[model samples]
Target: MISKNTIDQVFETARVEEVLGDFVQLKKSGSNYKGLSPFTDERSPSFMVSPVKQIWKDFSSGKGGNVVAFLMEHEHFTYPEAIKYLAKKYNIEIEETEQSSEQKQQEDERESMYLVSEFASKYFQNTLLKTEQGKAIGLSYFRERGFTDETIKKFQLGYCLDEWDAFTSEALRKGYKLEFLEKTGLSIVKGEKQFDRFKGRVMFPIHSMSGRVLGFGGRILTNDKKAAKYLNSPESEIYHKSKVLYGIFYAKQAIAKEDNCYLVEGYTDVIQMHQSGIENVVSSSGTALTSEQIRLISRLTKNITVLFDGDAAGMRASIRGIDLILEQGMNVKVCVFPDGEDPDSFARKNSQADLQEYLLENAKDFIEFKASLLFEDAKNDPVKRANLIQDMVSSISKIPNQIQQEVYIQECSRIMDISENVLFSTLSQILAREGKTSGVQPKKAPAMEVVRSPEAVKTKVDELFELERKIISLLMLYGTAEEEFEDMVLKENDKGELVMEPEIQKAKVFEKIFLDLQEDEVAFTNERFRELYSRIISLLNEEGEVNIEKFINGLDPELSSEVTTLLMEEEQYRLHEWERMNIMVKTKETTIARLVGETILALRRFLISQKIDDLSRKIKESSEEDTKESMEDIMDYLSLKKVLSNKLNRVM
Candidate 1:
């Protein structure tokens, strides 16, 4: 675990604008910066970052928090991972406290796998750069492929010796367990013999979006016809090929900046593009694209342009991915390289400006690409052309946005030189067939139960809830402020008439709230509020003044998020600087006594009304033998409710 002092230092040193500016292109909007939300697809910006508050809010997704929360949401980082990222960015050294033996044993299995993968990545890189054979064979292969030393080092290229157990023996000698080595697909063990999996191959480390090495892909340089040319690590605890896209860690910022991503097929294709100054590109690791990979890019940008190698078989295999992208509500385009060239070779052959210009001029929208590719084969045959038209409609129906689907349908009709009515009818029939075969059933409506005075009861409950929230806010914001509170004391005089005396007393806000609630036997109805109430009172008793920032840091994420939300509720209004406009707004400090008294009176009245409701229900359901007793209880509750209602100036 990270030390509290280190976390605080990170929070204090890191600026929200500086951190978010790395991933988002923020434009100055008054006191805050606004950008398109990284979490959703939108044209206008709804993501706002407040430097003064050290927080950000994405109105599009309803997610808002401090700098750490932005990383957790956008990068999918854990709390400690986010803190460490900020600390590194701000050049603050992190200090982690030592854990107990049992605490170390209880670490998560996923984290252990990540640790092993990280260690193996460093091991492989060291082998490539330091060892003699690695310098000769591995470094030579990458250099021959037109990769500079800078590129090789940036990608963390490496090599494994051709011997069976060379890498395995060294790993075990370094105290790494055999189980983790095998689990991470770094070693293969059989009986008493253990061998390296990527022997005699140049290695490419595949990284997660947050720059953790998840797995490796190896390329064999040998000319052995029986050996596979390329090998990838098997699925492991931390690496799922379908869910990861290579080069995403390097490409995320560029993708967000360009509002577009170039999708290729191999790791080398991604590396060469980045080396050529086009950083907004990722690869599917030579696998057929999946919905998961498409969704990954969708988080950064809404536009994807897939670059094909111009091979017939490869293009045929990649055509299915187009519909998958469309199904995710993303705009997709297709760009093919020259007849004999792939992304790697083409990028090397052209200057950066020429390559960028070629891409911009050649990229075709998906509707046109689909129609042109399919039209060539069906030009001579009427029957085949009919099937082609249906295929186009099927792809169109996969789009979730109705307006986009209609636009594509019109484009398809124009390209096929067919009537729009015919295409629309075909699409409607396909949709109906799909709906019928989708196994959807009409849901039965639930029966409604009638309740008495539900609105009145709900309004009363909501008032109490608001009062509870105010009480908690006071305790958290100003629990130690001392103030004068008037006490109501009732006594019987000599004439047997009741008289009331008001006594003034000075007490802390927390003490006053605690005694008032206790006198009325009032308890919070919400579980979280109740827990906070008890904790606040306990802390006040122990330390007199609660250090809210320190208290929040020690809480779990959920509770901490709730507390931050409460504190930041009026952040926008506070940032407006109303005082500069010569407008004076009353603050909580000036009217805390009135606020506390009103809140307590409202809460007590609500509780009394609830008691009356419960007694009324009991009277209605009472047995004949218990009817009289129930009625008496209802009468007492009614009188108490009337008295409390009078106190709050409410009509019966």
Candidate 2:
């Protein structure tokens, strides 16, 4: 476990804007930075990062958090991973407290595999630069591929020696267990023998979005006909090939900045493009495209331009990935290289400006590319032409956005010399048949009307959530600020009966919140909210002043994310911006008394209204013998609700 001092040091040293800017393109908007959400696809920016508050909120996805939470959410990293990442980024030396032997044994297996993979990557790279055979084979192969020394080191290109047990023996000698080596697919073991998996192959280390080495892809340098040309790490707890794109870690920022991604086929394709000054590129790593991969790109941008080789296989590649991109509501454009040249050779052969210009001029929409490619074989045969039309329609049907589909349909009609109505009719038939076979009803064509839910009915339960959120937000922002609180106290009068009297006292914001909620006997309906409420009260009791940073660090990442959202949701203007604009927005500090009373009263009213409704329902459903008592309770509840509503000046 990371020590508290180290976590605090990391938080104090790490700048949220600088850290997130590496992943998303942020432009200045008012006092905050705004950008398209990295969590969801949005053309207009709704993601806001507040430097003052040290938090980010993505209005599109309802995800908001501090720096650590953002890393956890965006990269799917564990708590330790996020901390370690921030520590490394900010140059903070992480200090870990010693754990017991049993606690040490409980460390995650995935982390163990990661450690082993990282060690092996360093070992391989060292071998390539320092060893004779590795220098002679792996370094020579990479140099022949036109990879410069800087590019080679940037990609962490390496080599695994040809000997069967060379890496395995070295790893074991270093006290790294064979169990982890085999698990990371750096070494393979059988009964009494062990061998390296990528013997004599130049290595390409594949990284996760946060730059951890998840796996490796190695290309065999030997001319042995029996040997496989390329080898990849087997799927393990840390690596899933389908979900990872090769150069995403390096290209994420460029992709967001360009608002488009250039898709290519191999690791070299991505490396070459990056080298040639087109940094916004990622590769499928020579694997068939999957929706998971498409979704990954969608987070950064909604436009994907596939760069295809001029060969026949490239045509098939473009066709296979086009529908998938369209299904995700992303625009797909294809740029074909000149005859017989691939992205690798083409990028190397042309100047950066020339290559970029060629891409811009030659790129065609998927419909145009598809139509032109298929027309070659289908032109003279009516049957083949019909099949080609159906093929185009089938791809068009996969599109979820109606407007995009219509645009593509018109483009297809023009290219194929078919009428729009004919294409639409075929598309309609295909959608109907597929819907029926898939046990779904096809949406009614073009004439669909929007339906709105009824507005006449209102739920008190719904209003309570807003009130609950407001109360929590205030507590998080101003919980330690001092306040004078007034409350009604029950006391005995001159007579035997008890009467209510006013009591005034000075207390902290947290005290007022706890006492107000306690007096009302209200409980939070949301589990996370209730958890935060309890934690705040406990911390206040244990410590005098509530340190927001420490409190945030103590909560789980998910709960901390929620707390951040509540804290940042309503803050649109910073103090400096407001002053500059000559706009005086009321803050809790100046209006603490009124704000506190109103929030408490609002929550009381919501809870009372809910109770009154429940009693009313119970009275109607109760047996005759119990109806009178239930009705009496309902009347009392309604009377209290009316009083609370009047105090809040809310309509009953």
Candidate 3:
């Protein structure tokens, strides 16, 4: 277990905006920052981060939390993992109590697989750097490829020995389980024998965005026609090729800095591009581009430039990925290298400036590039040409943004020498076909149903608005003020006659609001809201002043988002500074007291109105036998109405 002191230090040192900014692109909005929701697919900004509060919230998804909570949600990390991540990011030294071997053995299967993968990575690195054959083979290969020793170490490049079962024996001897080794695809087991899966191959460790080794890619050095030249770890609980992008863990910062990502095909393509000074490039490792992978890049940036080899097959495959990228709302550009030269070779021949300039001059939008490439083949055959047009229209239809689709459609029409009307008709047909097959009904009815009766909802909404405003007033102003109030009580005299007596008591408005909430048996609509209210009340009671900044900082993201949202929303009515000065507006303390009192009264009135309506219904339905019960309910309702009326009059 990590010490509480260390956890506190991590939280104190790690800034929420700085940490989340690595993954999310934030633009300042008033006192907070807004960005596209990372948790959901949307173009508009709805995710908010409050620097003052040190927390974030995705209003669309209702996921909010502090820095630790954000990591837990965003990365799917455990509590300890989140703490460790923050610790590492902030360069805090962590001291944890060591777990016993038996206790450690009780870890869950997923964690065990992670441990096994990590251990495999370290063992491979050790073999490559420590052993004679590994040095001559793996290190030499990397050096030949122009990978600096620092780069090699940074990427953890390693090699496996040629001897069968070399890795398997070492892992088994180190207490790692064979089941996990096989599960992670590090070891292959057949009949009664087991051997390393990537024996004699240089290892490329593929990592998740958080830098956990999810799997590996191995390259064979020998010229065995029967053996595959390149192999990847099979899909496991921790690794999915379609969902994982190689080099994202290392390239995220660069991608964010440049606001663009360079997409390549193979493992070496990524390494070579990085070594050649293009640090923002990543690879699909020759797998088909997937929506999941596009989204991973989309989270970092919306612009991607695909680097393709000049071969015909490579061009066709590269074209296939463009539509998927567009579907994820990303802007894609294609750059085809010289014939027979891939990204690795092409990048090696040019400086960063020249290579970047080449990409810029050659990069073409997907619609323009695809239409130009396919236009030649379709020139003689009108039917093929129409089919190509349909294919372009299909790609355009997948784009989520209507404006983007329209622009692409116009571009396609102009380039293909087709009329805008004809292309639009084709787009319409494609959309109609998709709608029918996918069962996507029109959204008109659902939108209409959301309309509510203005008059009926206005009263409730106004009541809530008034209450919220009053609460804010108290929170901001009279959170520390004490006031003297008269309390009425009944007492028996010596003659046993009941006498009304008045007692004076000193009480703070913050205390009054807290007690009133408890007395009314009312609860907040949300748990986080309730917790924050309770905590604020506790702070006010103990210190006489509530530090809004400090309170917000301590809250988890969800509560922090709610509190920030409440605090930052502009009031409908604003008193000008000069006008307020002339009138000598109520002191902060008095204003808070009045606001709290008025809010309670407004809520009481709303509740009383509801009760009156319920009692009226009961009175109409009651029979003679239930007359007494109905009468008692009616009296109670009348009493509540009187109290509400009195409170409302004071507030008004």
TM-score of each: 0.63, 0.67, 0.64
Model 3, position 7, has a per-residue lDDT of 79
**Tens digit per residue, CA lDDT, model 3, 1-652:** 8887887788779888899999799987656777887767777677777787676777667667677777766765667889999998888998766778766564456678999999989999999999999999999999888888988998999999999999999999999999999988999999899989999999999999878999999999889898899999999989999999999988886786577999998988998889888888999987999999998887778999988888976687568788888878898888888888999998888899998899889998888778767889998999999999999988888887777777887788788898777877777778888782222222233433566777767433555545644565466446667776444344667996544365666787777767767887876654554566677777777887776556765666556656655553321112123345665544444444455655776777677676767867877788876867877876766665565565456431
Off by over 4 Å in 1: 1-64, 73-80, 83-109, 436-652
23-142: candidate 2 lDDT, tens digit per residue: 789988767898888866778777888887788888878888888888876765667788899999878897878988767655556678888888889999999999999899989988
- CA lDDT scores, all candidates in order: 0.81, 0.83, 0.78
Q: What is the lDDT ranking, best to worst?
A: 2, 1, 3
TM-score of predicted model 3?
Answer: 0.64
Which 10 consecutive residues of model 1 have the lowest summed lDDT?
436-445
Best first by TM-score, ranked: 2, 3, 1
C-alpha RMSD for every candidate: 9.4, 7.7, 10.0
- Report, for all candidates in order, the number of backbone clashes: 0, 0, 5
Greater-lDDT candidate between 1 and 2: 2
Residue 586 shift from truth in candidate 1, angstroms? 19
State residue 605's C-alpha deviation in candidate 3, in Å: 20
Residue 600 lDDT, candidate 1, scale 0-100 = 72
Better of 1 and 3 by lDDT: 1
Question: Clashes in model 1: which pairs?
Answer: none
Please write out the lDDT profile of model 1 over residues 1-652, one tens digit for every residue: 8998899898778888999999899988777788888877778777777675566777667677777887877776768889989998889998868988777655555566677778777877888899898888888888888899899888888888777888888888988788888988889989888889999888988999889999999999889888888899999878899999999988887787688999998988999999999999999997888999998898888999999987867787789999899989999999988889999999999999999999999999887887777788898999989998998888887887777777877788788898767877777787788782322122247689877885566433467668888899888777888888766555557986444456889988898899999988787898888988888899999988776555665666666666656655544444445778998777777977767766776777678677768867777787976878877777766665565566557898
* Candidate 1 Cα deviation (angstroms), residue 75: 4.2
